[model samples]
Target: MPERQAFRERIRLEAAERFAAGAADAEVAKDLRVSVRSVRRRRRAWHDAGTEGLRSAGPTSRPKLSEALFTVLEQELAKAPVPHEHDAVGDRADAARARFQSPGPGPPGDRARRGGRGGLGD
Candidate 1:
């Protein structure tokens, strides 16, 4: 989980403490730079389930790449490309993906057919 989310949860837990102390939701919201509606909801949760209700759910979804895979990818991207002769593929998509070309001497049509990032070919 990102540090920001954990920090935000800590903030919400703090709000819960304030709620337990009888602080108003609006006051907590203003102090925390959050919506009054959000404070009201948190307050309700604090009353019902206490601190557990305000905890982070951890990651919302599984990552497409694992940490090890992501680290390998970053390392691969950081390496220099092989020496080759090839025409530039596209003005934009090629620019984005140019750093990672196949071992072949030319740009493959695969990206154009499968659709480049942001559907640059489309």
Candidate 2:
């Protein structure tokens, strides 16, 4: 983690001293050069919760996708091979150029065709 800024450390230390000496949070705010609401927040966080409350919540995490599910998909894909149709050399060159330019997850029908379950092979 990065070091705390000099101004923030100063404010926290001064505010802590004022709070410990029985000064009102608003008084601490005025003397420490910070907001009254911030003083109250820091006081509650320090007294009621401790250092954890003063720390950032940190980044959110996404659940990991199952490796077993990916293995199952690979197994299914290996069971059958789909036929591919090709045109003349000129058309093939144009198609390759289009593929390089767009490169999208083509159409859903193309996926089904490659999967061997669509009517094209049937």
Candidate 3:
């Protein structure tokens, strides 16, 4: 887990102090402008352990895409996608067109060819 911001860490520490002084969860939550659930959770941790339980565990995540790979992905996305040898690509394109194209003033034969209703209630 990434560490909470410094202010947030200070807030929890302050809550620990209030917990030590025997302040109620609602009172702490209202004073801190934090959720009552959060206050209750922190209170439980404070009761079980000291303020150390409220400390952040530092960052545990890494970027899914690195900087160099990200640039290549950005360039690829900037260009238009073209279908090549894959037969399914054409089917996908046709499905996308059907999904996006609103019914317009076209011929009944055209609608039938596109696998749609020729008119209302068809």
- Best candidate (score: TM-score): 1
Q: Lowest lDDT 10-mer window, candidate 3?
A: 1-10
**Mind giving the per-residue lDDT tens digits that candidate 1 earns over 1-103?**
6999889998999998898899887889999999999999888887798899989888888989999999999999999998975566655666778767766
Using all chains and alpha carbons, the TM-scores for the candidates as numbered come to 0.54, 0.37, 0.48
Report residue 19 deviation for candidate 3 (angstroms): 0.3
- Cα miss at 76, model 1 (Å)? 6.0
Question: Candidate 1, 24: how far from true, in Å?
Answer: 1.7
RMSD of 1: 15.3
Off by over 4 Å in 3: 1-4, 63-122
Candidate 2: the clashing residue pairs are: none
Cα lDDT tens digits for candidate 3, 1-122? 32456778889999999999999999999999999999999999988988899876654577799999999999999999887775788989989999999887776478768786766766
Winner by lDDT between candidate 3 and candidate 1: 3
Q: Order the candidate numbers by TM-score, best to worst.
A: 1, 3, 2
Candidates' lDDT values, in order?
A: 0.84, 0.72, 0.86
Backbone clash numbers for all candidates listed: 0, 0, 0
Which lDDT value does model 3 have at 73? 96
lDDT of 2 by residue, 35-114 (tens): 98898889887787655455454434542647788788889889878787665987889988888895656677886667
